[model samples]
Target: MNSHHQIIKTSPASLFLFCLLILPLSATCNVEKTVVARCIDQERDALLKFKHHIQSDECGLMDLWGNPGTPDCCTWKGVSCSNPSGHVIGLNLSAAPYQKTCLSISVFSPSLSELKFLKYLDLSSNYFYDMEIPSSIGSLVNLIHLNLSDSGFSGDIPHQLGNLSRLTSLDLSRNDELSAQSLNWLSQLTLLRDINLSGTDLSEATDWTQSIGSLSMLEVLQMDHCQLSTPLTSSSILYANLRIVSLSINYYINSSIFQWLFNNSNYSTVKQSLEYLDLSYNSFQGPIPNEIGNLKFLAYLNLSRNSFSRTVPDAMGNMEFLKYLDLSYNSLSSTIPDEIGNLQSLMYMDLSYNSLSGSIPSTLRFSGALETMHSLSYLDLSHNRLEGFAPGDVEDSHSTSHINSSNQLEGPIPSSVGGSSPLLHLDISYNLLQGSIPSAIGDLHSIVHIDLSYNHLQGPIPSSLGGASSISYLDFSNNYLEGAIPISIANLKYLGYLDLSNNYLRGDIPCKLEITKTPYFAKFTYNNLSGSIPIKLSYLGYNAFEGNPNFHMDKFQGRCDDDKHDGNIYLGLYVSIGLGFYTGFWVFCGTLTLKNSWRHAYFRFLDRIIDKIYVVVAVYLARFRRKSQV
Candidate 1:
């Protein structure tokens, strides 16, 4: 009986061991099940649904999915972020639909609505056949930005967008359906900071000022290129908060109307915050207001391509922060104010194509910021009546040149112009300044382009000129600058254009000279230059020297014999261009064999070819000359 009891107790021990082993396994299984319940089947479900939709679509979503349409729409062109879960916030599906056989709009991926946290939705740069915006966009309230611009949507914008209040920046530029009326729902949005409705036909905008003006926090309102019938002048206070404003290429062509409309808006306090203002290509006239200087914060002001008249205001000096000042293409007259130089931050300045006449200011120190600009290029003061050396001391290191007329303004250039600033471009043509060319002029190291034509600068040409190694373009034509062509000009490695026509400059051209790489054009016409046409000048035609009255050419086989060559030298230039190309090609080929490789094979080959060619040419030339003598 005791033995039987022991056996039953041992059997229970085996059963207990089995139950303990299964307990941990059960716990693990349970935990795994819980994780599965929590994890969303985002990828599998979304892709599966996308594939099914592409496989069968009644809304013709297959067109956007493209021909031989993929079963999985997410795999189509321009489609990104196929995950249905909120993990994907950016989706750029554009220009996917191209169905010539089935030209119809379709919602290819209805599962896109499954993405709850999409922040950026760009369907632009596409020919998507979407005539109406997908209504599911309202479901993605987590969106901070939504762009369906240029997606072929032609219907009115839905009011469902009023739900997107988190937007700080919005762009609907280049949309045909986006009009002022469709965007009128944006009046109540408080978080909006930027909005672009450019290229939209908003001419039918009703109560636009009352609607758009209420966006108090809006800093950039780009309704540029819009056809708005309503004048924004009524909401000057609304637009005053803007730091950058561009109304360029609009229909406000009436100067009086534009100014009056601009004045209707508060130009006083609002103008102060404006940093960059572009009113180019508009109809703006009258003297710029004295209040314009109130924009102390304004740094860049472009009033070019306009009809603005009267003298520039002295108050402009108050804008110490002003940097880029472009007043080109205007009728501004009178001498530039010495105070104009007070803009300490001034860097790029373009006063080209204006009617300003005067001596340059002396104290025009520029902004320190100019030193840091990587592309701070172009300072054009051409086509104006600015005479003498632009003010300031020629001794100043920054000055390109100094024109010291001594108030006895002569028709000849003064010698003191050598003291002016060393600008990249110096155009003092079409003036009455006259004097002998100063040797100090050669000291201008920063001079790259000089147009001293149509003046009375005379005396022997300085050979030291163009030794700076930076002169690229030099035109001394229509002047009394005489004497032989400066041999020192050969030092100009970067010279691309040389115009010396109508000058008293003489002498034969030098033998060893370099006139830039290709794409070079040089002129010495109407000069007293008497010498054989340089065989090296096979590339350049004659128009560059039309005015040289006493220029003569040596008898050469290559020189054009016809007097017609003198009347219009550029006549057969196009036909002769093939010669330039032919020579350039051969030279490039010869250099290619030697560059970097330093190949001994190439060297030997070239030496043999060159020697053979030289010998042959010499023999041919001697024979030809003997025949001529005979």
Candidate 2:
């Protein structure tokens, strides 16, 4: 009876331990089975059907689809599936590293629409040939992103695309044959935030701007090169949330669009949100409105290749966040405002090809306590009439500087130039700058191109210039620089274009300057250089050495032998001709004197020729007289 009692107690403890382990194990198995069942069989079959329709899989990405050994379709390349449900939601076939694997589907496949839960589809940069976008794509109501850019699609965009009301981004750019006869369908998609229709024909879509403005949530609108000519109505309400707008390469005739965009009463939200505005390559005329300063968030503004005139507005300095400002290729006049120094974040400023006249502002030098505009890297003021000294203290390291053509900048080049900044390109040609070039110029070790031509710079060519090992183009032509050509110039291995012409440089051309594999362009014309030309430099043509009176061509005979031999050949021909003429004349005279029959035959032939000429002249004179009488 005591042993039975012990067994009952042990049995109860064992049963408790069994329930603790085996019951939880059974629940865990059921959970795993439920997770595996979430990957629906129907969705896997649909993905397999879609892969079979891909006419070309050059990248071999479709090999994983529908393999029974790997039953999960969620692990396929360029595909994404929802977490637990395991439904296909995204398919991206953008041609990136494997551009050769571009799809070339001749006909649009309806199998893709089978993925009912798909929200993102990208097939950009492929070779779909001349097939139209499939009308059946509208069946995907859950799609929020669709990109078919540069896919070689032709014909009209389907109106059925208006069904995708949830789409936030749509890019159909760079399909040259793509056309949109009407954009009335775009109004249905209110959730669109970005739209890029560049290189598509929208000439007939006169209400394109209005249609786009209706989407109040739109942030980016790019319609470049669309052959658009219609002007935006002054009273039209533009999208308030727009941050980027590119309308370049169009033919809108009116400048009033600017007033409508910036000066409109309803554009307060747009002015604050707009960041990038590109209106380049248009026919815009008249003064740029001062009201543009209201856009406090404007960072990039490009108005180049237009007809904007008058002074640059002083109010532009109020845009403290402006990073890139390009106003080139315009007829703008007047002085660059000192207020320009207020832009603390300005990085690139190009005001070239204008009629602006006056001295460069001292504030632009960045030398004073103002301490703004320090980020300036690229500054081009070429082809203008600005005068006075070059900004001496303007120090931006590795800056590309251009002040060439018709400027009256004078005085010596600043010694501080190479001390602070390693210049990339420094061109100050066609200016009135005088005084010797600073020897410190060699400190710009990163200098690539240097042009100080058409100036009054005098004194010895700096030997220190050879320290600039990266110099590719160096021009000091039309100056008064004298002394021997610097021997240190031979150290420039990267010198591709070297011009010291119209100067007073002397001495023999350096043999080290001769590059055989890729010959350097060298011009030393009208200089005082002497001695024999280098044999390798002879290929540069004789004009390179012309006007150098002391240069001896005969000393470099190995290279000039062909030219000398050709001259000798002409001399021999002349002598032979003269000797032949003398011999023939004497032979004829002797024959006439010794043989009377030969002389008479020659005289008879000459007489016949003279008689024919007289008869022809008489007939022409008679015809002229008869016509005059009539």
**What does candidate 1's lDDT look like per residue over 531-608, in tens digits?**
555655645656544454554443222433343465466757765898899999989786767675756667789999
- Candidate 2 per-residue lDDT over residues 406-496, each given as its tens digit: 5777877776666644467888888888888888777778888899999899998888888887888889999999998877787777888
Model 1 regions more than 4 Å off: 1-86, 91-114, 122-140, 146-163, 174-182, 235-240, 253-272, 358-381, 386-392, 395-422, 542-630
Count of clashes, each model? 30, 0
**TM-score for candidate 2, residues paired by index:** 0.78
Q: What TM-score does structure 1 among the candidates reach?
A: 0.64
The local distance difference test score of model 1 is 0.62
Residue 257 CA error for candidate 2 (Å)?
A: 2.0
Candidate 1: Cα lDDT at 267: 58
Question: Candidate 1: worst 10 consecutive residues by lDDT?
Answer: 30-39
